[model samples]
Target: MTYDLGVDLGTTFVAAAVARPNQAEMFTLGDRSVVTPSVVYRADDGELISGDAANRRAVSNPERVVREFKRRLGDPTPVMLAGTEYTVSDLIGAVLGDVLRKVTETEGEPPSRVVLTHPANWGPFRRGLLEEVPGMVGLTDVGLITEPEGAAAHYASSRRLTDGELVAVYDLGGGTFDATVLRSGPAGVEILGMPEGIERLGGIDFDEAILSHVNVVGGGALDALDRRDPQAAVALDRLRQDCVLAKESLSRDTETVIPVFLPGRQFEVRLTRSEFEDMIKVPIESSITALTRALASAQVTPADLSGVLLVGGSSRIPLVARMVSEALGRPTVVDTHPKYAVALGAAVVARAQRGEQALTQRRTDTAAEGGKDADSPARGKTDGSTRSRRWPVPVAAVVVLAAIVGVVLAVPHIVDSGPGSGDQTAAALAPISNTPPLASAPIPTAGSPLPAGATPGFAAVSPNGRLLYVANGDAKELNVLDTTTNTKLATVPIPAGPPQFLTFSPDGGRLYVSIFDVSGAGSEIAVLDTSTNQVLGQVPVAGQPYRPAVTADGRGLIVPVHNPESVWTIDTVSLKVTGQTPVPPDPSWVELSPDGRKAYVVNRGANLITVLDPASGKITGQVPVGAAPNAVAVNPRQPLLAVVNFNGNSVTLLDAGTDTVTTTIPVGQHPQAVAWAADGQFLYVVNDGDNTVSTIDPRTGKITATVPTAQTPTSISVLPDGTRAYVTNLTSGTLTSLNLTG
Candidate 1:
């Protein structure tokens, strides 16, 4: 059987995507790893090794290495590798050949038609080189796809955009940064204009920043040793590799310790996230600038774009996402799996190319027999949920787009024969518009929570996304909605007065609610069986509870009581009170880390946040915050916490590692609740006083946007896919849905 294959022949790394039946499966090259370093090296016995093996030996055998040859493409210069003078094209072909060989071994056959992605900014000169390199590696039939288009295909595959909508592709890969704008229509993605590129900037640049910081902070330790030792080159090479790991580490960690060791020298240094950001700030800014230029070139503004799709592994950098979104004033959509998105997109391209070619041939045959014109609109096939069709891709337009996009449109009978047999046909598939045009998002939309004037405050989404549990301050019951239809599913009455906060256990089997102002009830904790919306039991408490958090183990429901100024832990399995830990006065909010090792609680009266050990129910540490701190959140991926201050009108960022405030960022008036976006890179604070939601960058401690909401948005929650953010109004009884396409 023939396979549809896409190869992301990146400069620093190589990723392959093979189209199977329904999904595009990604495969590793050279080694059994998802990503292989795109480097080729010769060993002492003259055997060629690439990827991790080549990268590892580079530190000890620098003379035999050739890395990042993609940067040198289009140049005819022949560089000496080992004992042979191989051109940049030759080296790339070798890498491409290895990738193809590995794929053949896995798939039992070579790809019938290959889709090779290249940097969008490449012109005919450079593109010609890339185009011919694939054929040289024995892949006779190849379709050239821009790196940005490949990334766009990945975004489009999710069926999110409307037909003919403009979307920008912001690619920050391991070795390069590229920004391209494309318009998705019935005829697939057309180049918005031209592509913009940063020829030598990417994650590698960030690694260099760490190296430079080491030179300055290490106090000449690395540099002095580099000059004296015969293996200094190898030592510096090893340091570069270590720096790459450190840079990636900072993505999920606030700080990491760098250990510099030699045969007789050893030193350990602490590098903070802020310091690393400072070093790479300039290069990171360049990527944002390139995105701006690409937008301008496309004759489109930030507001005109549907969204910015950020792909490539380097995009994992918290700084890159924040900066690009800030510069474009657009919601940047980070690829869920950045490294493989491009390769997966390639497979989509291959399928589209083959299908279009087949459909086009059919049209031509029909046109000759008194049938519809070949240039007519494409025939479509829809199934209510998805819309896919083959639009007419004129031969002329195909030629023009191919040249501009580094693609060689394979129009069998129309175009001149170039690669493979002249009769061989390929697909030039149209862009499938999956979702209908999105209507203007309505803010301040009210939902009729039961009990008439009961005000909806906070909501929790089931882990499976099957149900949305909405809580209110005056309602005596919990309102449940089927997330698929956004309608009331069931309302369960509670034992407490009004539910103020709702949370689900990690397993999503049990529901926990924090209630306040119960007339006869001393405690305000309610637990329910989600399978039937039946009340399981209520845990007795001594004070009014404001927020509820489930421990990492899903065994304890931690509730913070305001009046009593203590946190109570209820054993979920036993359905009884476990223990209570005393904190500062008016402790209103609580959040646990991803690992569930510790709990962060906000004490409003003392203007501080206390860290508690869940297992022992004891205060471990306290960090001073703004006045009247109300809501607190910890980024599960990073050791950072965002604490909202009601009285001070600011959010203080705390590094959980040190239990200290790194920066306090001003926000909208009377910030009530704060929650992290999908990836935990940004925080959304609902400002009750101003009736707006502030998007905050937890890494930089800055507010990016203050979107107006319905009256008194008390709490917020983002969907699992980061597509939507629901904000509940405390007084208006409305649920504001924000289109968070990013």
Candidate 2:
């Protein structure tokens, strides 16, 4: 027999199915059912046991029995059973091998090919183990599909769904909760969004809650009963079993009696559905929150969803169903067995591979056919149908051809333009020379005036090259410097506390300041009007707002909240929060694209930049940066992104269009801040530990110069005309202005 198998090797359950020659005749092993509990045991003689046999041995030999082995797949720790040490991969292999043997025995032949289902968040290490399991089971060629994707494909195929249909899959399993949003079509299923839950949570948590309740009701006697008398211990064990039964029963009933037995005495404790709901409310609420976030990420409302499918046995809980329904405002579809859906879907996918069904072609053909039918009536009903329709066909074909030609012609221009495209004239400017003149004069810092009591943090020059704002943490203010005169003009008081970072509005009329607050009490952002040189307003933000940026239109300000997983968006006009978008942890800096449509937030903790659509509040993509991206600067004239890595001591240049790191330019020690020249001629980076400024030509992405500065130079910026630059030194408490014209 040529069997194509799909395996769902879950933490608490293992399921496998085989697609027959006839696609509709897919058969599941074990009485033709799709699921089996994932239980394993090792005998004293080192023989492996699984499924019913292992489950039967669980109570008698708890030490040697292993359940939920999938959870430990990524851990380096090994499990010792019956004096034999086995890794998580080995344990999983045992379960998978057992299932493979059953399929072979049931079909009276070995399976030809297999596909494995995995969680979306599985890393390379975990994926490696998953791939290894199929090999161990003697399946040489194996494919992998995410659990959610498998379930989504199943739903889409069963209903003959088309592409662009958004669906949410909420999987509450034995050890983890995963939520995913997918768009199904003829091109297959594309994952639009995915959010993970606590790995420590699941049905086991509910069981533990019940066990805890049993102990509480039995009082201290439950502990004594286990140790003092053998008969009492057995009776106490029975109570634990009864608690589990009652918990499952409460899902379909309003109340259940959990019986506790000790020696010759027996007592009954009643549990209401309300009490059970209350017990697991936090977890259920968390699941709802994850689902909400998944929808938000996909930029869809509950009304836009086709449906919400519940998968995994834990999703059978009454509270889980209720919470999902309430949050999504749609009835939960639990028609398919939660534990078997993924495996069944995978089996269906396997049949598609065997040419029994065309999964990808189904939706595409339907859409095209539907479009043709819709257009037929329009062409026939029009007054000048013959000529008008004929003209439209040629015109549309010409317009499409012209558009393709336009894109091909503009490729070079787009490559030269930065993300901002803010300065069209900059692209026409002559290329600057990288090699300084042999007789180049030293930068005139001899008469530079240092601000008193100012410990500089970061600095930036206005777009028009008139003023430079330096974050002076020790003085608790921003020292405004006159760029032309190389002198301090005024110290603007920052009531939001100590200034840590600064960015100017596109029009250069406002300055946005972020303050570092470590007490966890909270942080505040102070907006100052550049013309008035006075504080306009202060808005409270969660954690310390580490870095700040202003949108190109000056309509919004983005701030990174360090602790909590969010970025704060404030309306520049109203000076109020428009929204807050959750991000990866420890977002230390942010930068907006030139068009003001997208925002890039640097997640220091995750070592990646989350690209967000500010208008839709959705993360469009993520780009991996160097270790600890302390600062990010985007060139407006081109699709260039420069990130300074403090620990890695290098600047990573990313081609935003391709989302790939083009080059890594090694810089001085501890690069802290990065900025692009107004004309996009050069990229400047400040090295805090080395007290130097590294200059690179963006076209070549090579460091052309390393200009030494005052002690501990923390920030650097260039003038709009590209004739001068500014550096803030924290230890020396000074802002040094460099003459770049020479």
Candidate 3:
């Protein structure tokens, strides 16, 4: 057979289609079905089984099966089957190969041309990983197409699209949501602007939401089901499958019953379509907001769009279509088989590729069009032929420094820049202290601003350096201080327990407060809206969460926890725990390299630092530091990391690039916290035992200044302009402002 083929390797399902003269025909990969489960199982014989066979085998040997490997592409972490490790590419290649084998068997030959569809918001890194799949499947000269472009192509294949007409695509898939706008051009449908995506918002989230509702209605019976029981896992699996069926049944029917099977109990819960709609309303609204932002980024109004095209399995919900139409006030078109739309559309693109014509134009490398993070610096323009661009560090630093200088004085500032597409180093202004300006500089203290018996623990500054948030552990609240005046602006009450640690979003729009486990009520992370300082919601953790680090992408949080000896990954979009990675004991703090690819965790009990990939939570390497490592920080401008040793009274410096110990420098007694200066020239160590802050020149490995602070200075927050630093004292319940510009 000499047909062109398109394959959609989705998170939950896989679909394939072939292009004929004027139409695309879907391939039946399942028993009388057009799609197959995207799952793979490693049998005892070491042979890989996929689709329905794998799905069935997983019931008894769940440990050997892998699902949703599509979402883990680009992650260096590998999935372990029994004793063997399988890379994400290997798993995807297996499923893709299965699809290819079936299609080839039916047609009596392999397809001449093959095309694969991926999420529109995928940067070059992920796209590059997907580009390797075809070669592994014994296919050559394969093409790649964005999912939205494929859907738009399939839509245009049946209907005539006028030139310059704009159409929007709202793709809510199993694991992610992508919102993109495209325009009809001479060549094909071209993306108009940067696509907006919610990486954790999709059908899987809705399924979780429904499962949560089940737990609530079942009087927490599901929660009480002991997972340690051998039958519990299988019961829960079947319950989840029932939930998926119930969710789908409600799409056409008004109500459905979900059968719940626990270890010792079995029951059915009635669910109405209205209840299901209510459960998913908020996330659907979030998707609509993404669509609106995409249109705004394209500089076009909703009225200018020819119509809104809905694709993906999740987009078939009636409520989704209704909300899209109401939100944009435009006609919405839902595909008859939304799940297979991307696959069919890929066939269209594949046929065009076979003719030496690129149906869709690649986006130019620019600030708005290319796949750059929102905080990334502007990139040079391209001719819309290439898919990648190199991001220079100096150029990024110039842009980041300019933004910081515009907000603060014309002084060096450490702006925590987000990670760019691929291998783009985050830009931060280095503190150029060629001359040690201060020797034994003293700081003024803001004596106990709160009521008596209040213990302040941790502190952080906003990105703009306008506000400082102080966690009052004893008071069970967060004290907001105006940095200009060094006075209290407001106090926001903590929800569940005393606030233990505090961190802010990169944009300063939200603040995350880790709450202690009070009276065995369990711990949680309280989320607050910075604009109003009001508690928005809370994400429950399995154990007491220590200091959490927000990922460079700003879409997830890496939380180090105690009691269970694991780190949790929280998707910021849904405020839900997505994954857990086990680590050494007593993980206290987490720090990310400026580039954000690696996360460094300080294991206080183990006296070592564990380095892991932030995306996959897979441990990459480890560095042994001084005794009782309490805190860690990465230099903004250099490839250096500083780890504070509480018991050893020293700071261990490591090379962030190689994860190797560079040197160790002596400091004051009980150095509990460490921070890099704005220009990356100085290191600040907060000594809890000595109640002093030691300023060390890392280049010389000598203390430049030792300034007295409030009693038991436990945390430090340096201002963005490198002019001052604030130290929070736990015993004195006050803040000491140190002058660094002298």
Candidate 4:
């Protein structure tokens, strides 16, 4: 006997099913996990590893591992692994081939026909890429369907849908989100309108948040690790697994304990479901927004839709059900096996194509009062009324529900505008120039007892922008990297106290590092000659300094001395302090104007930016800002000063020329530091509490992007080009790089 094969290739996970007789059997590969993570890792010896092994190897070999690749399908650029580039299709093919191998091992032969499913919002280029995969893997005859359509087919098989009845499909997977509305008719299932989808928000994002939480509050043992260490891989993999289990457990329970194990020390973290919901609230709200847009485009209200099918493994999160119900004013429809629903739908079609009897003893969900239906197969058998209806060929999610009496509907009227309804041609066909390659390094000082930026190394770009220097705290070393190759050029060892701040000369010829003691003593600046990549000399300062700013002419460096409450200006030529300007009780960071004429220092104790004339040790002006002002930034081209208020969770915009307050803009939780983008058009603020980098428009005072970082991001530096940025995560000890263009 021959069985039909179906493949469900997901961004975060992969699954396959074999259909025979009346039921679909999940094909397992090596492990019992019916779903395999779509990850590939390049082993130390050049071995290509996939699935669980790849995941297991990621902690130690992060740079060599590639996942979440499906999101970049049809992109002109390929993935780089172990110094080698791989096309998008090549990565996907690896997963498909592994699934096929499982099929051959379990079924004893290749399937006669195969059905494939992907997101409904994918455009022509992505679809074209997917279509080519089947042929590459030796699958002769392949039928393709959108994920939403496949899920609808699975639901339609068991539940009878009346002609013209419409159902909404909400599929939230690991890497993306999609919402579709489908209708059943005499011809079969057809899409009512354009599908709704969010490309970036997904389950994986939630996982990352939880992972960051682990790093921040999980205790001393858990910190960013160097992939070169074998334990690093094992530790990270364990943490991820624990997070997944904890997340899954929260679906049924109110709280779960996550176990974090290090070599000698281990700890258990108890997390509440409510807390998790809060962490992922943004994405949930986004999905709800997309859902409403899809409903509007479909011209179908919550009351008009027959069923709201919740598809994808991530839908199991209790928050999804609550949010969808609250927003739609009705409970969502779910299958007992929501994770496997889409694959099941494609599997049934595959079986039917193999000439097997389509009738099955399947669970049929009935439209009920609360909008919730049975998810288990024990509920009921397939309805004979919709048995003749088959999945349509051209694709969209298919769905059917019994309508009241006879309502003759000629055709689906779909609206042309809304989110995800645009001509998706730009999605895959065009090269995504904004997407940039990123590199990360473990801040050896992460989780150290020292304060935020002081312990976590901060990055600075040389004047010429050719090199990026990252000063580490506990490691007591400076990591010099080549920007062009994203490779480490050298590690310059410095005296032991964790570095709080550093600055490059205007010409990028010299580097100045402010090293501070954890106990708030022994403050000094180590001057490094960029040419030789060595510390030239150490200039003793009166007190601990956090962040230092360089003057435009490259002649002086303004250092904010914290404890002693003084700002010191050092002459570049003499390599000695010109003078110390006495300031408020505690100065945190300093910013200098373009002309090297003025200095703006954020005084933590004074709640103001104490302005000083660099020419002499004198106070020029003081701009009162929010309480606990931590850092300050200046726009060279404009007379704008941005002050990050730590406790206020906002940024106070000050007019440098008039020394007057201009605007008070709200920011993320516990804003710690601020920097002006090269153009002065935008400002980047590091939010330590939320582990996010908030990009704000200086003119409108509105946040543009809240890019998530590892944990406790303390310091951020951007190149003059504004295309690249580096953030130091204090607790996580991970130096994160970002592509500013996006």
Best-performing candidate as measured by TM-score: 3
Q: Which clashing pairs does model 1 show?
A: 188-431, 353-427, 353-428, 354-427, 357-427, 523-541
lDDT by candidate, in order shown: 0.68, 0.65, 0.73, 0.68
In model 1, which regions exceed 4 Å deviation? 30-32, 44-47, 225-230, 363-742
Report the number of the highest-lDDT candidate. 3
Pick by TM-score: 1 or 3, better one: 3
- Write candidate 4's Cα lDDT for 423-524 as tens digits: 211111111112122111111011112122234557776543445667778877666654432444455667646665788776666678888777766778
Q: Which residue pairs in candidate 4 have backbone atoms (N, alpha carbon, C) closer than 3 angstroms, thus clashing?
A: 59-233, 60-233, 149-397, 161-400, 161-401, 162-401, 443-733, 463-508
Please give the lDDT score at residue 151 for candidate 4: 80
Q: Worst 10-residue stretch by lDDT in candidate 1? A: 395-404
Q: For candidate 3, which ten residues in a row score worst on lDDT?
A: 393-402
Full candidate order by lDDT, most accurate first? 3, 1, 4, 2
lDDT of 2 by residue, 358-443 (tens): 42355456557774332322111111111121101100000000000000011112212222232322211222222111111222
Tens digit of per-residue lDDT, candidate 3, span 1-742: 4798999888888999999767798999987578998989998988888998898988877777888777666544578986799998889889988999989888998887888887665555466677887899788878776677667767777777666777767777787666555665554444554443444556777888889999999999888987766588778777888888998999899999998878768888999999999888755754554443455456678788767788889888899899888977889888888898889888877776665332122222333575544354333211122223211111000000001111222211222211111111111112221322111122222222332136878899877665678888877777775453343556666757889888888877778888885452558988887766667789988788999999766899999999789899999889999999999999999988888889999999999999989888899998899999999998877999999999999999998888999899999999999888765767889999998888887877888778787688899887765546788889987777765533
Worst 10 residues of 4 by lDDT: 402-411
Model 2 lowest lDDT segment of ten: 397-406
lDDT of 4 at 222: 58
Q: Can you write out model 1's per-residue Cα lDDT over 1-742, one digit (the tens) per residue?
A: 6678999989889998887647677886645678798999987886677777787788777878988777766443576888788877877887888888888998898876678888654544466677789877778768776676677777677755566676666687877666555666655655654454545667876776688788778777666774545477676777777888888899999999887765466776689889888877755653543343355445666777766677888888788778767766778778889988889888877866766666767888888886867676443211111112222221000000111011112222222222122122112111221211111111212222222136787787765444567775665666665432344545566655777778888767777877777553555577776765666787767778778788767888888886577888888889788788878898888898777878888889999888999889988888899999998887745788889999999988888888888998899999998877655656788899999888876655666677887787888876553435677877778777664421
